[model samples]
Target: MRVGAHVSISSSKATSDSVTPPHENIANAVFRQKEVGGNCGQIFTHSPQVWKHQEITDEDAATFREETEAELDGPWVIHSSYLVNLCTPKDGLREKSIDSMQKEVDAAARLGVEYVNVHLGAHTGAGVEQGLENAASALDELDVPDGVTVLVESDAGSGTKLGGDFEHLATVIEKADLDIDVCLDTAHAFAAGYDLSTAEGVDDTVAAFDDEIGLEHLKCVHLNDSKHECGTNKDEHAHIGEGYIGEDGMNAFVNHPDLAEVPLVLETPNEAEKGFEWDIARVKELREN
Candidate 1:
């Protein structure tokens, strides 16, 4: 399994930030992974700011692939910007959202990234049903280049978010074409009230995902621990094995029969004085056990 974190890729190399051009970022991430003892990872292709547009040239995309392959030593995945919310109410904003999503789609295709994961977005006071429809419409309107597919990530279900449960994600995928997929976030699933820590709970959750969202569509997994309790409906990420998910829950996820074959990325908090040493060790232990 590919296990790593959401690394930052900054535009400026002089700064200590993790943000770099896609190629440099991947190369750097590989180094960071080795430094922190990670075997696999994921990163955002561009700056996540939705308000600020990012431009990618053909030479940049090509060089990025070349450098990443030459420098990094792990399977890599790309995350779309956080600003994209397909469930928006305003028509103009919806158009911009679609445009932005397509840009990422295009970039992913050019870079040959296997998956482009996206959040289903909060409805912003709009009805959940409407938000789902809007999301479906936006996805249907997008033109994804060949060899790249979009994965809708499950959220914490706070407020008008559409992907808190299997049913909501199923509805969106059902309405859209078959190419779309889903990425289950363990923390969000737990905060959304799915008890994934227990054997029975993990089985039930996987069963529901299979029956409702189609297990075939599950392309990725976000291995995060929730800072909130079950049913909290909040989005707070904690270091692995240190929060509400606990060591047992993480073990359950790592050893999950269904998730065993899929790639798992850590979006865990790893920047404190302690660094990601503990988090990496926890995942390694689980994988070994």
Candidate 2:
């Protein structure tokens, strides 16, 4: 039942050499999150280094743990970089994707992060089925750290991206041969033609997910409202209750008994203006009403 946003410590206020390491700032950010009334938080482990190029020393890992456990009160999650594209047909990109995923798994294990969430990428002209298999193949090459789990994020289905629908995600999970899970984005699901705006549509969508990927495998929920209309295949994110998915759709998903205990993260716009305190309160309001 923890809730928070992707807070950046290293990137927030710094220069090339002047910037603090990710672990330092993230630990402090966790304290800020708690002050802002968040029960848990998410942070990135390192800078934009390519998977193979990035390096973390043992001292840095020890520092990160000490800072986080001292500053934060709950679980912490890590988000993989956007640069990774497992579905790319090209050999170089596929190799990089697999390497990056493995690096993330290692980093998460070092930092004690329980889950690493990643997106299914666009397939270009490779077609959905091929793209899914490519994604699964890349996953097969990466080792799942003992304490960490990998979760594929549902995309908006824009362009040639895979994982916009339950069937595509199910295929990737089934073919991956890895202990993978899912992170459902309400806006993405609605935009990808899941029809979560209505009661029946929401029920149908949930049922499909249960049958296709197994609801038990759902590890996290990204609570976002869509700026585009349902089935638009767009990925614009709006604030809660202010966009297409609106209050009704989000309410049902957040309050569903099956997901009541899972962590919910907000990736909405205008948090600096509206504040996560208010945003999370709004989500709490919807859950109550």
Candidate 3:
């Protein structure tokens, strides 16, 4: 099973014997993943809150690629900025979202990362159909690099956010001119009313996904446990097997035959005592051969 966590790429001096000195480059993401016993993972090229383009030097890009290939069984994904609202009705916000996404895809190409993940943000007054159209149009504007594919992540369905339903994802893929894929966030899907807290629920959700959005489009899974109940539309992630989607649900999810090939990148909280390392190990333990 390919599994990992979202790791930071910031520079820091050596803190302890167990920790390596963080270099002032993106390659530190790879090192951080290795330290946490992850084989594949996700990274933010820049701060996710702000709309900042990644200024990766050629040297840093080269180093990142070399280190990733040599040290990890990787299909690293670059998570786009939080402010990128492809579903926005306003022109200025839509244009900025497109620009931010383009930079993210280019950065993914430079870093040899295969996927660039983004959310189809809140529609903000536009109806569901118009929101889907806006999202597809925004995605069509990007000149995506070769080997770098854009993945629209499933949302928690709060307010007017798109991608909450499998239908929204399928609609965007049908409407978009650009070739794209989907990343199913477990917590988000559960929150969006697709129950995944038991083996039967997981099976039902997988079948629904296959029926609405083809299984072929699922390239990755944002493996997480939800803090809220099913259909709550909340997005807080909890430790594996310790949330509403308990041990039974997570076991079913990780070991599902249909999802066997998809990479699992965890965005679980980094709290004391149980962080990415512990989460990754727990996932491995849950996987049945």
Candidate 4:
């Protein structure tokens, strides 16, 4: 399985030298992935809290693509800004979300990344049907490059947030005119009432996902353990094998044949002396030959 962490692209040096440009210094993500023993991973184009994206110079883009090709077994993904609410009912927020997403997809193309992952966000009083329509229409606005595909991530189902149910995911894909895919976050799925705490639970959840959304559309897995119990709707991520989706569940999920070819990205907490390096090592241990 291809697995890695969501790493920072910020550079250690303030300014660029001979090889790389300042704005597009994401080449650092590649080095960081290798240092942590990851073969593939994810990165933010800018501070996800704010709606801004750093520009990627062509020179820097070339270096990033070349380095990634040479060093990693990659299909890197760029996670969109947190403020983007594709399901928003308000016009101002909806426009902002669309603009932000457009930039994210453009950046993904510039960086040679294959996927751009984002949440469907909250419906914010719009009915589920309208919210899904809003999301699908908003996605249709992007001029996605030929090789890039947008992925709607499963949410924790808190408040009015969409993407909590497998039906929501299937709905958006069906409604959207674009060729999109799904990124299943284990923690979020468990929190959203899909039991992933045992081998049987994992099996059931996989079957459910395959049924609701085709297995072919499962492009990636946000491989995380939940801090909360199944159906809690909480979004906290725990280290692999240590959270509510304990060792038994995690072991079963990783080695499951249906998921063997899907890439796993770690969004687990980096605190408590168990960072991505430790998490990546743990995943390697979990996978059986």
Query: What are the C-alpha RMSDs, in order, of all predicted structures?
Result: 2.9, 3.6, 1.3, 3.3
**lDDT (tens digit, per residue) of candidate 1 on 66-137:** 755765545566777788889989888788788888887887877767677888898898888889988998
Per-residue lDDT value at 143 in model 1: 89
Q: List the residue pairs that clash in candidate 4.
A: none
Which pairs clash (backbone N, Cα, C closer than 3 Å) in model 1?
8-18, 9-19, 9-20, 10-19, 10-20
- Predictions in order: lDDT: 0.78, 0.77, 0.92, 0.91
Residue 132 of model 4: what lDDT?
A: 92
Order of candidate numbers by TM-score, starting with the best: 3, 4, 1, 2
Query: Where does candidate 4 stray beyond 4 Å?
Result: 13-24
* TM-scores of all predicted structures: 0.89, 0.88, 0.97, 0.95
Show pairs that collide, candidate 3: none
> In candidate 3, what are the lDDT values of residues 1-289, reduced to their tens digit?
7999999898763323577745678889888899888999999999898987758999999999999999899889999999999999999999999999999998888889999999999889999999999999999999999999999999999999999999999999999999999999999999999999999999999999999999999999999999999999999999999999999999999999999889999999886567898999999999952
Better of 3 and 4 by lDDT: 3
Error of 3 at 144 (Å): 0.5
Model 2, 66-100: lDDT tens digits are: 76677655566677877889898989988888888
Model 4, 114-209: lDDT tens per residue? Answer: 999999999888989999999999999889988999999999999999999999999999998999999999999999999998989999999999
